[model samples]
Target: MKRFIALIFALSLFPLSAHACGADTDCALGDRTYRIQMPDTAGDKPAALIFAHGYKGSARGTMRNKSLAALAERLGVALVAPDAIMDDWSIPNAPGQSTSPDVDEIAYFDALKEALISKHNIDPDRIVVAGFSAGGMMVWNLLCARPDDYAGFIPIAGTFWAPEPTSCDTPAANIIHIHGTSDTIVPLTGRPIAETHQGDVNKTVAMYIANGGYSASDSPDMTPDLSCESWRSEQEATMTKCLHDGGHSFKADHIKAAWKTLMSGN
Candidate 1:
């Protein structure tokens, strides 16, 4: 009788098992909601990957892409997809447009990271950031704002919006720029807005080169694959520019290749 009582007391003192939270319409951040998908496997600490959607896109937008989820599962990593505050993403305005300034996207990422850490046993060193289109721009900003928080970044169909007198205070984070040469929305040569134009792939690559201290003459030959395209970074830093043949759409093959590269460091 005493042993039974002691067993009951011991069980009461222990905490219950906590599971990874799934997509709940009730879970919201600012004016937006999130759809977080974690691996079903149970463990004390798991690597995590946070995904941001493009303009006018929801968490579901990226979640529907089975390839991303599959990669996360294979890697035993958690996947968190958060919605942007507004339907539009916060990107740099034209060269001299003073009326509209870039939104505080870094804050959103910080908040989301805090929430994830509080809820899960995530490995801080293995965190990865990935996004599409406008979301890609957000990823680039996050890399620049908080380079140490993430292991790497994967930006698709988006360029780094260069601020006037470009000043990136953070260190160079591993980056993979996946773009489409035929992208009409955010063209490789940049799109012409009212008076000024936004930065393009060339400008983005240049910024990375300048900030990352890479040699200009070391442009490697393009590696052409059936599903995607790739260019190796000249510097020792792990960076690459992948230009595919399709338009502004997410390709599963491209994502898979990117995932392999990201997880290879592990």
Candidate 2:
């Protein structure tokens, strides 16, 4: 989805199965709706990628990226993208506007994951979650709420507003944060969301590092187009931040880079 004014936003290969979905499907979670795609192989217990689209974007809008489809093929994981009720996520309360649904989004997400696991026999340990922009903020909230629920997290061009949680419910998972140095919408330096303030990208990373109990060490790995850095604590957790030259947009290369980095171990 293109970055339009207000809003913005997996891994693993399990075995091949005989009952995979060849195309996308319109799935429902009580009153909410989402789009899901299964691999051609009928691999039960396959890995899953749950994607949250940018604000005001639909599941179909997110799937239009093409890279996500390519990602499913590349990683052999089922792809699922859920739509937000108000075309905005329920992060911080926007002035004169409600970003998310009146319902419990956390519970919605939980049900979504459980539905996939039960229907497809997905591997709970291999489920990875990712979001962009507002969706990315959702990922941050998810991390704070259920850090142990996923194997990996990728928040692209995302941030959290003031009143964000200072700690997570459990140990953090492997995380890779990708952002653009030139983004003004959700700038790396941070911006105000309604009456609250979002932290800078660097500060956001530092917060995640602190939660994971990892200390910053070694200089950032640099390249012509990107600056990549990581904070690690032995085998406990690893967090990587990548800043590129693009604006607030999700490039195909970004998805590819995230998949490569997060799926490197499995």
Candidate 3:
């Protein structure tokens, strides 16, 4: 009996099982699911950087990028990559794509964020959301839907559909939009996505500038293969338009720029 009691006490002290998730897994939230990565410091409630992958892309795929993984570790940020319903994010009223009313992408995001906050003690004010391509459009949609939810945003290679918001629902968060000048998939001048037209990048920037109280001045900044023109609003939201020789892709330099802007609080 004494030996059994000692064994039980030892087992209790070092539990036989651990329930924390691995580097990546499908975490179910009510009727939705998200692919999450809890950092080594997750128990300490580290800041989160949630990423929405491009249309038809998986969260694991994005996490597999060595640079992104290293960035998460280097910055001490918890990385949460949520999978979209129907294999793609449902942007509001976007053509050629599932709409949020049907897929409830917004609800999924809400659930995911709440879960992270409750379970991992995430800092609400430190959360940022970023995306690429179709996912980038969803980032803009998220800003429109829940303007105050995130600390910042990075939308790459995508923009809102026509009739973009002239005003934000809430005060601005830091925003950095990265686009390739040679992107034919979603042109800077905008094009028909499917049945509707995505708005011009300049118009989107203009509206943000007006609403964000930014002066209409762009300064030059050069990257390895891209020339960038950057503008900042009084609210600290920034727009960095990069003219790259490539198309419809997120480069390592773009990630670096986005991270720099995010860390700088602009």
Candidate 4:
């Protein structure tokens, strides 16, 4: 974690990376590296979106695709895409597991935000954290574990892995989730494990709604389509589910819709 913090500090000093960094250099947070994508207009103090990639993926891979970058650009938001330690999502098998290589990912985010705040004109209250697949699981962990730090969350094809309802720390942030009903990697029905209990998309949504002080009857009305699917909450905090036609991989249209939802809140 210290190493990753040092890298992020270094990148903040010199914002530059070879590919995804564009003009900004890749920042290190322990053994991880991240890429930043800024909005076209300068001095706008735009809302920042921090992105976590899927299992075995890098920030560059997540941001390299034009469609994802287009969403950030269209929304006029800045993106911070970070690489996971060991090129994989952290899901230790043991209970009370110490983080691999002692990389405290939660703290890494704090440091990244500090650097971003110092270097960019960011709206602190509008910060959003987003992720895909295993990274989506990480997103939920952050929401439950570090609820006070962020305004909202976006998790794609991910599940909650808490052992019990009480284990799910109350989320002070709103959330939007995108999942495929047929996702094999992280099944829509969720998987059973020893250390923690994994939850389906619906369960996760319900949990978030309850945590956000919304009743079960307040669940959003769904608008399903061939290209996109949406569920909007009846409360101040909104939860949307984008049902992908296929499985596993992310759909650009759903991501675009998610971006639209985030921008709408702003």
Candidate 5:
């Protein structure tokens, strides 16, 4: 009966699936909405990469990156891009215009996960969240505050905000932190802004490692575009840090490299 219905719909020259969103359309949910693009040949329950936009960036802006779209298609994964409430993630202690601290950011991600699984036919266990700069900070906070939510994290050139976290939760999943060695905007050692400070990126990763009890992998390996250091308990989890020789800039290639390194072991 299902096939018959689908055949009838197909014969009508219209796609059976309803309202699929891409670079041009928005997937509205609650008061928020995100944009998504699935690979042309995506398999059943294909993996997804939730790429958060950087500071003051929007979902439409993220979707407009053709390279990112191509990368997702080449990897055969769904690309999910979400927007911040006000051009900035309302993280507590993070510099933003919000008068009230955001408790919705976490909830928003939870909603996104549910939406992906129920609506998109994506693999629940293979969703990896990644971000650049301020969005990268959001990735860290998500992993730190909610360790059990996603399969992995990839944070590029960002870390915690002022009043650095003393600890993060356990059951820490895999992480691939990418950064630029010459970053002065969000330095490795971190820099101060007004009354707040950008927490050291190294310190943030170190805390996760110590808290998660991940052991270093014995042998070292390198990728084509970037140099990386790794730590892992292969039976359970992995944490890797990759660095390039650039400044506080970003490219889809950085996330592509991180995605390769993260999925290689899993």
Candidate 6:
């Protein structure tokens, strides 16, 4: 009896597994699912950053990226990584990845937003959405169509596909676009992927500027590794365009820097 009691005591010493629904566990809403990891340093009401994965990427993979997760932890924020459909977004006119009539990513995002606010208990006002490459283009679509859904937007290494959306809902949220000076994959000028050419970063930013009526800020970018310019609208929204010295890369540092600039107006 004493030996059995000792074994039970040893088991009890280890904390009970309440993590089935927590970090490392995938949370589902409808047919889609996402994973969330919270920072230990953040308070009870920490903000969230919903990061969309690149083409052929998964939420599990994004969550496993130590560099990105470390940045989220350092910022005292919750990191939410979402999965794309069939390893690629349902982009319009995207060759084999064309949008399905039944596939409504906007609807999925809408549900995810409400799920984050209600089920996940996140601060709706402090939520930001960001992505990389194809995911970055996804961010543009999300922010353009649902401007009020997130507090801020960050798109890295990608913009709209060719024949970009002519109009976007306004006033849009604060956005800080990050790219590389030597990016040949999704170059600053853009290149043909398969059947469609990528959208020009200048044109994409210009569309947002025209829609939001943002004014340029003469202040120089503070980060030495990046070249940045900023703009602001009367609605209190900020716009930023940033370029680094590398090529088609995903750096957590870049995301951190852009996040700071998006929050800090010129």
Task: Supply the global lDDT for candidate 2.
Answer: 0.73
TM-score of 1: 0.76
lDDT of every predicted structure (CA atoms):
0.67, 0.73, 0.73, 0.67, 0.82, 0.82
Q: Give the clashing pairs for model 3.
A: none
lDDT of 1 by residue, 1-266 (tens): 99999999998775432232364332455554566777788377777878888877877766786887787787778888887656756656633432235456677788777767776667777788888887787777777778668878888887665332264545566777788767898888777667656466776766766776654332223335423323333434466777778788776556556666766741
Candidate 3 lDDT, 52-171, residue by residue in tens = 888788877877877777777767787788787676777655776466465767777888889889976888878888888887888888876776788778788888878777776656
Better of 2 and 5 by TM-score: 5
Off by over 4 Å in 2: 1-24, 93-96, 99-101, 217-224
Candidate 6 residues 48-86, lDDT tens each? 888999888988899999998999998888899888867
Pull out the clashing pairs in model 2.
8-54, 9-54, 9-132, 17-41, 17-42, 17-43, 18-42, 19-42, 56-87
- Scored against the true structure, residue 23 in model 3 reaches a CA lDDT of 48
Which tens-of-lDDT digit does each residue in 89-150 have in candidate 4?
56433123423746677777777788677666688877888888878887887777776677
- Whose TM-score is greatest here? 6
lDDT of 2 by residue, 80-146 (tens): 8887877677765443364545657788889888988887688888887889988888887777787
Model 5 sits at a Cα RMSD from the real structure of: 5.8
What are the per-model numbers of colliding residue pairs? Answer: 0, 9, 0, 12, 0, 0
* Distance from true location, Cα of 64 in model 5, Å: 0.6
Give the C-alpha miss distance for residue 250 in model 6, angstroms. Answer: 2.2
Candidate 2 similarity to native, TM-score: 0.82
What's the distance in Å from true for residue 33, model 6? Answer: 0.5
